[model samples]
Target: MTTTAVDPAKCRRCHRALTSAKSIATGYGPGCAAKIRGAAKTADLTDFKPAQIAKATELIEQGGILRTRRPNLYTAVSGDGNTTYLVARQACTCPAGIKNRACYHRAALTILAAA
Candidate 1:
């Protein structure tokens, strides 16, 4: 009689022990999964909203516009320090800020505008 069993040392990618729990491609035990999940909380996406990310991306891509509500805001940059651009609320001047929705500058701008 033959019994089927999973090899612990086999890695789906390199056929070795998947040391990095981030390798979701190759599944490990539940404990490993849980550990990875805990490590990647923001990426878990249990309540992920694609629309929100899309909207943020759009806002960033559109860039910021100077408005009467918030003065002294910066949008785009130039070699000259005098060349200041007013950024619209929640707008980011970075690609990652637009696509990945991870712009610290945008966040800072928003906070400053709010305050």
Candidate 2:
């Protein structure tokens, strides 16, 4: 009989070694998987207008996005020294976000987090 060697598994999100059977099967660590799922849910719920999507895509292509230590939170800095915090569930600190409107920061965060 021929023997097969099993390769070690790693999380798809964090690239960490997945020693647990469940994690190996899912391809993501428990924490990472949970975060990804939550982000995906948020992303699905977000509605991005055409302008917002264009702006978000430009920001992402320009590498102007920054992920914060807090989960589901991100800081986006513009070339003009303007900074906006995209808080999950909570509204962003930008003017548009403060007015209860979807901002480019939120759209950018949704795109990045979903990825």
Candidate 3:
């Protein structure tokens, strides 16, 4: 049996009532998740190109699948192939994603190719 964080409150840093927690990342109430998710969206403007974004997205998916049995299957990174990270429902494997407001693989493939 696997147990990944589900309720938002279990997350490390969320201030509102949480409804859903998918992956090791915590989700906030509509107010917070929207804001954070938005920040994650804006993060793509930094430097990565569309191709890199797609690769990153694919890493997350592969990591997600690798983590499918997590909270029980032994935590592992769900994004990026370089580093294998410890993941929970409220946290991610990469420092960039954890340190500050960063984009989830959710926006990975969506980054503008022109950017």
Candidate 4:
């Protein structure tokens, strides 16, 4: 019988090769995983509206938020999935955020970080 080649594990966020068993099992490198835990600890959701938080949770469940190469930066998909906006801790490129209003993209980021 021929042997099948096994693929090596990689980080989920950065796609970097994982050498440690813990990293492989977690599907994220130590650094990338730390970003989520660290951000979650410092996140403040008090200012966001309940509706916004609910929508953010929905967005995340639908896999609408994606982590970028840079830490604390992510791409958030629009409601219709036609466009993507850059989201950071303090800002987002969405229409509401462009006008300095609260946007669900940022809320999604917080929710994702906590997860």
Best candidate (score: TM-score): 4
Question: Which candidate would rank higher by TM-score, 1 or 2?
Answer: 2
lDDT per residue, candidate 1, 1-115, as tens digits?
9999875543321334655554433333345434433433333233324543344223322332223444554554322334444444445445544564544344433433332
Over the stretch 50-95, how does candidate 2's per-residue lDDT look in tens digits? 6787777566545466667887667776536565555553567778
lDDT of 3 by residue, 1-115 (tens): 9989765353222445544555235322445435444544565445555654555445433433233443422244444444555433334455654774343432342321111
- The Cα RMSD of model 4 versus the native structure comes to 5.7
TM-scores of the candidates in the order shown:
0.26, 0.54, 0.32, 0.63
lDDT of each: 0.40, 0.67, 0.42, 0.78
* All candidates in order of lDDT, best leading: 4, 2, 3, 1
**Model 1 poorest 10 in a row by lDDT:** 57-66
Q: Flag clash pairs in model 4.
A: none
Best by lDDT: 4
Stretches off by above 4 angstroms in model 1 are 1-73, 76-86
User: Considering summed lDDT, which 10 consecutive residues are worst modelled in model 3?
Assistant: 106-115
lDDT (tens digit, per residue) of candidate 4 on 1-115: 9999989987766789999988876766888777755644456777788788778766755557878889888898999999999999789999998998889889877756564
Q: Which candidate, 3 or 4, has the higher TM-score?
A: 4
| Model 4 alpha-carbon drift over 4 Å, by segment | 1-43
- RMSD list, candidates in order: 17.2, 10.2, 11.2, 5.7
